[model samples]
Target: MNRKFWSIGLLAAVMLISAGCGQKPGAAPDNTPEQVTPAPGGQTGQGNEDPTSGAGGASTGNEVTKPETKTESIKSYYTDPDVMELVEGTANISYKEDQDKYEAAYQTLQKSDNPDMIPLWEKIEMKSLKFDNGTITIDVHVPDEANLGAGGEAFAIDAIKKTFFQFDEVKSIQLLVDGQQAESLMGHVDLEYPMTR
Candidate 1:
């Protein structure tokens, strides 16, 4: 999938800035291991690892360039089947220098290193996802095979929100079915468009 992305440094810098905003001015950014920001008000994202592993930046064309990779530390958020709450895990995604980091991060959220957590987006499919000026527009299509019941819908949304919001560069999200706006992704919850952090 072709995706646009802000530099990993930019994403981290945004996260650092936003993380500091919730605290006193000049305060340090929060990296609490077990931090959990409730849903609907998910102002914080799950990432805590320093995004300092970036190497080469975005490239263009089919020009043969140096073989370099960008390794970004990501926060993986999954739903706990037993507790019904989000379980957090740290993951590292390495992609081609010209590849989109957001795509790697999104894929990381699909499953967890911890087996106890359930992948929130295992069955759902995203047609397209784009990020611009702090907003992420996600065009999704859920097939009947997913069977994401009412409760499952809530968990999926929460997990997705928290997973992306962990990046301070993302200020809001606009969810769409196919390519148009909708009240809900699965006719379960009242999905408010342009959901803010």
Candidate 2:
């Protein structure tokens, strides 16, 4: 009988030690990576806890954390025969360089749309962009100038100006056609002078 009691007591002690070893003091068991949830407010969570809440307590609404935003502003143009206005939009150009930024901006303009707005650079090819001091010169190849209908030249020019001028580094823009400084584009806007931001 003494041997039986001793064996039972030893078994109980071992079970207790194993249970205690499974969990640390004041800490929860580690969760598997697959069980972890993402953080609040669209941010990624690091662990199995609510990311918006503090470590010690529930989160206050005011203490909510926000994910870092990666975006750049591009100025888009909309023309109204009665009035002209500036329309601003955001683009994912944070990873782009200066030339890439211009290309991205132009591509955005190409894709951007508004019921009252006319798209610029439609069917126009962007050959290259050159930066010198504060001046930005763009060489373009227009397959057809007749595509720019009535008052389209002004709107196109405005769109180019607003888009490139969004960057402080560009103080002026000089348009080039087929690698030469044409006197005018589509016989509407003069290309002899560089447009200032």
Candidate 3:
């Protein structure tokens, strides 16, 4: 009886070791790269051939490409005397570069409208825009300071600030009048320092 038990135990251990060594019937070997599904419109992974490629598996080079562009709809502010507050108007702008976007914003601010809003940018010309370290510096050519009204000056600054600050990248603004920094715009808000959003 003891000899029979020992033989059965040894046979069971051998069967278990052999079972661990071999793969199941249909399993594939490991370390294989995963198959990637092709992107729509006949685009495939880099260095991979597109199955839908024309004769001889050669690319037709007629794939539709999307334009690289950045666009934003910004609001320009104007003052309403009835409410004694700033009113906003929207302008859609598309640009390939950041400078173009800034120019578009300035142009939108200069547009004229009726009693609901005041256009303070009529006499002001945007000279340049500089962005550095989350701050934007805008240089403008202003007509004679003496001719600028106090109310207009304040509304102009507010409109400019509201326009640029619409972008999340802009944290503060430094205003320059004709390449020189002034103490204030018509004795209203100080332009000597940068204004935060």
| Cα RMSD for candidates in order | 24.3, 12.4, 11.5
Whole-model Cα lDDT per candidate?
0.72, 0.67, 0.73
- Model 1: residue 121 alpha-carbon error in angstroms: 0.3
lDDT of 3 by residue, 1-197 (tens): 99999999999999998897665633644554453334665445544565666865546665445447888877887666643566788777787778778887888877755656666676677788888888888887776843346666777788888888888898999998778888876666666468887
Error of 3 at 161 (Å): 1.4
TM-score of each: 0.61, 0.54, 0.59
* lDDT at position 175, candidate 3: 92
What is the overall TM-score of model 3 with all chains considered together? Answer: 0.59
* TM-score order of candidates, top first: 1, 3, 2
Clashing pairs in 1: 45-165, 45-166
Per-residue lDDT for 60-166 in model 1, tens only?
Answer: 22223356787878778777776467677788988774226667777876666677878878777778888888888888888887756788788778878887888
Off by over 4 Å in 2: 1-70, 79-94, 113-115
Candidate 2: what lDDT?
0.67
Q: Write the per-residue lDDT of candidate 2 for residues 25-86, one digit (tens) a residue.
A: 43634655433334555443653245556544344344434434346765666444333543
* Count of clashing residue pairs in every prediction: 2, 1, 0
Candidate 3 local lDDT, residue 145: 42
Candidate 3 stretches with Cα past 4 Å from truth are: 1-69, 81-84, 113-115, 145-148
